[model samples]
Target: MSSFVLVDRPVPEVAVVTLNRPDRMNAMAFDVMVPVRDALVELSNDNSVRAVVLTGAGEGFCSGADQENAGRAPHVEGLGRPGFGLRSLELLEDVVLALRRLHQPVIAAVNGAAIGGGLCLALACDLRIASSTAYFRAAGINNGLTASELGLSFLLPRAVGSTRAADIMLTGRDVGAEEAERIGLVSRVEDPVVDAAVEMGQRIAGFSQPGIELTKRSLHAGMAASSLESYMPSEGLGQLYLRLLTDNFEEATAARKQGRAPQFRDGR
Candidate 1:
């Protein structure tokens, strides 16, 4: 792993991936995000990891693609300008996809400035919690580029509605923590956002592994479902699969009768 990214276990089942470039506001330079993408892939294959929290080390989360010095993107060394641009973007796009495809749910602990690709990074997570001092911006427009990069175009509208997403992206304005929460861009605002995110991760980690994973899948599917009628059956099947293959439901019943929390042992 590069020194640009740090992976730590705040709790046994929760892995926190911190972008460590505090001086650059943890910009999405290739050096920083490549390790970040690799780290998520590593955590995805670790069965013991039930949830992941992504945040930055210092006062900012990520300032988008490094404007001052975007280190060389992997596999772009010999490419022509067009190929180089496409490959570089693909590398960053993979990082966003990695977050969504991870087996465990991901939470963005937005501790400070989440701008441009940074905002997209937060939106890619399954959930987001921000520090009171944190803020967000659609920085691409400000830089004379399209405001859509790294799935921000699709995810932002789904997150805060098309009208609001349009307004924010077109204007390239800063959204404070309170506004972020109010607009549904973040789940809540906390003083120490990373700790709050870890606590949420711990709570989620207590559930049946397959249950949580399936729920995460279903939630994402629900977002893209063409129709409720077609989506209902797949969702129902997931519930039945867990119920029949695991003793989680029975464990819950028994634990309820015993006046204690359920101890789910579904290894899957």
Candidate 2:
């Protein structure tokens, strides 16, 4: 049987993975997390897929972990010291890592509440687009749990700086869609969030696949770089190699002269 994540191809080269548990607010339970990870891995290996859009069914995007299942078996068998919390973290962390490691750019379509680990999932995506009704919260702190689970501490600080991340994590307050966009947490806000993400995915998929893949890698590398100068060599080397080895650049030049769109090579 299929798990809680529903994967489909809505447009050419674009995969949409929707969290299917609306009654539970698409909570990150063990079953959901495993399928989500598997889906991402499958999509990543498919050369036909160039981009992905992740969203939830019904109203909410995801309300973090399903506290109802807190007493379930540990995600890992060896360690019982951290208890149920450790098990939950193991599952949630896997989903977050899968999203981040995906070669294709992922667009998070936050249609409603993205709480706790849900917000972390969005943060892991390359870009985020939310609906006007959407909201975000580090709700775990309010529930007497650590606020930084599922890599939120690392991702939030990088996206909005340490000051904002600290305030959000410490307070566990809700951040509305408008405020989210204003603070650079999200790129766009509209009524139908998934549609906006699909549009963006289409645009991204139209680019040269090799260039897009390399650019994503370079951006992630820049995050860990010590200084601007340190990152430049990586960027410069990638550009030099692409220009000399790939025919896409020459195709682009020819297309520009002819006032037409360049067709990227298949599986590029």
Candidate 3:
């Protein structure tokens, strides 16, 4: 609901959440990000929405925390300096977790620079697609701090592998769109990335709701699963649950025979 975040239903079942502070390159100020977290939570509960696309308003996706003016951290007005810092960080951590916890899939449209916390923000999403001009940086090291804020240390290694993540984070270098795609930091690079992300979201929206949600859950579970033996059964259980609960598989088969797309009405 904050002016800093704008949510629009660009297609039938897809919602686009835009970070609206172009002048500051949509910096991750508390005022901007708190609402972003709230908006994702709102969309998660809205059964009408099946997918989400997150992007920034201008050339830059987000320049990380605003150095000039970060605004006030929510609900920390009366705390000491150390307490305030901890609580402020917890707020940002909540945003990252919210993206992972949302029932609907989220695709980050990285239009331009995604530095420090901004990079972490994009990684938190289920998918990422970058504009041709987009770039990313593990900026904390450049700022004389560790490059580990907002789940960066945890997510980056999983995203691009530990060796590559170490190089990027330690060197504090920018990774452009092409390199990002090659390194698997992003799924693809395209012109007008938001449109591409929305297209991807629309494709996901066409599937059965429970099918998609369970798949997302399985993917996240796989990330933390101790071993293949521990993970496979959970994934199989999800498949069986949907296969038995809905007539989607039969409908898909019928549609295939009729040379038409699956209606996916049972899950809806």
Candidate 4:
């Protein structure tokens, strides 16, 4: 079969990747992670894809790694030998990195449990839209693993500030959808998160592809840009590049006057 991830184009420029294997609560097994990585890379390279929504197949988003296969050797089924000393762990890291490094914006439609590595996956996305039933936890600490694996330590603090991130990570407590929305972990909490995410993705996909991609890159870079002075150079460069190199601004102007959506290439 095709492994645990199901990739589909629900809209012209929006790709929705569903985490299959609802029986395991969409756990990240070796098979699942590898295919997910490949799918993400494929989508990232597709110029027609402008946005992506990552969600679960059933009730849960993802409940971390497969507990049933906890004792299994960290090796791929078909591949001869896994790379690195911590092969499986590093592979999981690659999945998260792929999401962050993707040119298109990714939306995490958190439908249910997002614990341990699952939470890390959501955190890596550009945006998150959670369902009312959704809950987040850093259960790794409670289960004897370090609280801050999979870039959690870096992403959490930047998201909710040091105080909240420290408390959540240290305690390994559950944060419900309401609390998550209040704390800004998710922008919206709706009945069906995927629908909301798709709506947002469609809106984003309507904009100029290069504009959206450049904006995502600039925002990510600005997160570590130290000071406004340091960040302005990158921002200025993007604005200049867009103005001179692309016709998006002119298209936007015409669209605004014409009362219609701007067709990006050649400005229809």
TM-score of 3: 0.98
Q: Over the stretch 1-268, how does candidate 4's per-residue lDDT look in tens digits?
A: 2557999888888899999989889888877777888899999999888899999988999899788863333454555444433677778899999999999999999999999999999999999999999999998899998898899999988888899999999999999999999888899898778888989999998877778888999988988888999789889898888788778788889999999988877233
lDDT of each: 0.95, 0.87, 0.93, 0.88
Error of 4 at 71 (Å): 8.4
lDDT score, candidate 1? 0.95
Q: Write the per-residue lDDT of candidate 3 for residues 148-223, one digit (tens) a residue.
A: 8888988999999999999999999999999999999999998879899999998998899999998899888898
lDDT-superior candidate, 2 or 3 = 3
Question: Candidate 3: RMSD over Cα atoms?
Answer: 1.0
Clashes by residue pair, model 4: none
Candidate order (TM-score):
1, 3, 2, 4
Best by lDDT: 1
Off by over 4 Å in 1: none
Candidate 2: how many backbone clashes? Answer: 0
Please report how far candidate 2 places residue 22 from its true position, in Å: 0.1
Kindly report the root-mean-square deviation of model 4 from the true structure over all alpha carbons.
Answer: 2.7
Model 2 CA deviation exceeding 4 Å by range: 1-3, 70-88, 266-268
Residue 92 lDDT, candidate 3, scale 0-100: 90
User: How many clashing pairs per prediction, in order?
Assistant: 0, 0, 0, 0
